[model samples]
Target: MSRVLIVDDAAFMRMMIKDILEKNGFEVVGEASNGFKAVEIYKNEKPDVVTMDITMPDMDGIEAVKAIREFDSNAKIIMCSAMGQQTMVMDAIRAGAKDFIVKPFQAERVLEAIRKAIG
Candidate 1:
């Protein structure tokens, strides 16, 4: 099973992602609510994949992606973004996110991003 780390400021968002990932055979290794925490957890857990939220307090997803990439260039990160944040999404991609999933996350899309990212 692929190990995953979910990073989102909203607890409910994290829970929702956890449920989706768990049901689809992905092992959620850790979760973080902010970019700083995300980076910390990424270093410790070293999960195979990461689902990162673009907008967050104390660091945001783009910065987190950069930080993680600095630590591990091979990191596979799938950015989660809300609608209307197209610019941010592009920035995340530039920061080394392998893929992205828009909010109001559909199960299949999330799974697809994860699969593609991990592959």
Candidate 2:
């Protein structure tokens, strides 16, 4: 099973992702509410994939992606974006995110992105 780290400002969003991932047989290694914590968790847990939220308080997903990529070039990050954040998504991709899923998330899409990212 792929180990996943979920990052979002909302606890509910993190809970939702955890539900979807665990149901799909993905192991949730860690979770973080902001980009700063996300980076710290990435280093500590070293999850195979990360589902990162775009607009966060400490640091945005794009900056977190860059930080993780810097720490581990092979880091696989999947941005979790809201509907209107197309530009931010693009920036995340450029920052080395492997893929992305939009919110409110579909379990299937989330699983697909994780599969593709791990591949």
Candidate 3:
């Protein structure tokens, strides 16, 4: 099972992501509510994939992706954000995210992104 880290400002959003990944047999090794903690957890836990929320109170996901990539070139990240932020999503991809998911997330889409990201 692939280990996953979920980063979202909303507790409910993180819970939803955990539920989806666990149901798909993915091991959720850690979670962070902000981008700063996301990178910390990424380094400490070394999760196989990360589902990162774009708009968080501290650090934001784009910069976090860059920071993590600077340390670990092969870090697998999947950006998760609300619709209508195509530019931000593209920016996340440029920052080394392997895939992107629009929020109000569907379980299947999340799984697909996870599968692709981890693979």
Candidate 4:
């Protein structure tokens, strides 16, 4: 199973992603409520993939992607955004995210993004 780290400010969002990932055989290595914690956990845990929320408290997903990519050029990050955040999504892509998943998430899509990212 691929190890994953979920980053979202909302506890419920994190729980939802964790549930989906665990149900589909992905191991959740860690979780963070904001980009700062996300970066720290990522460095320590080194998960195979990360699901990053767009609008976080301290640092946003785009910045986190850049930070992670700077640390590990091959980091696999998947941005998670709500509808109508296309520009931010593009920014995340530019920052080195491998893929993106829009919320409220669909289980199938989330799984697909993670699978493709890890691949």
Model 2: how far residue 116 lies from native, Å: 0.7
Candidate 2 residue lDDT tens string, 1-119: 89999999999999999999998899999999999999999999999999999999979899999999999999999999999999999999999998889999999999999999999
Ranking by TM-score: 1, 4, 2, 3
Off by over 4 Å in 3: none
Relative to the true structure, candidate 1 reaches a TM of 0.98
Candidate 1: clashing pairs of residues:
none
Which stretches of model 4 miss by more than 4 angstroms?
Answer: none
Q: Which candidate is the best by lDDT?
A: 1
**For all candidates, what are the clash counts?**
0, 0, 0, 0
Worst 10 residues of 1 by lDDT: 110-119
- How far is 79's C-alpha from truth in model 4 (Å)? 0.4
TM-score of 3: 0.97
Model 3 worst lDDT run, 10 consecutive residues? 110-119
Using TM-score as the yardstick, the better of models 2 and 3 is 2
- Across 1-119, the per-residue lDDT of candidate 1 in tens digits comes to 99999999999999999999999999999999999999999999999999999999999999999999999999999999999999999999999999999999999999999999888
User: Per-residue lDDT of 1-119 in model 4, one digit per residue for the tens?
Assistant: 79999999999999999999999899999999999999999999999999999999879899999999999999999999999999999999998998899899999999999999988
Runs of candidate 2 with Cα error greater than 4 angstroms are: none
The TM-score of candidate 4 is: 0.98
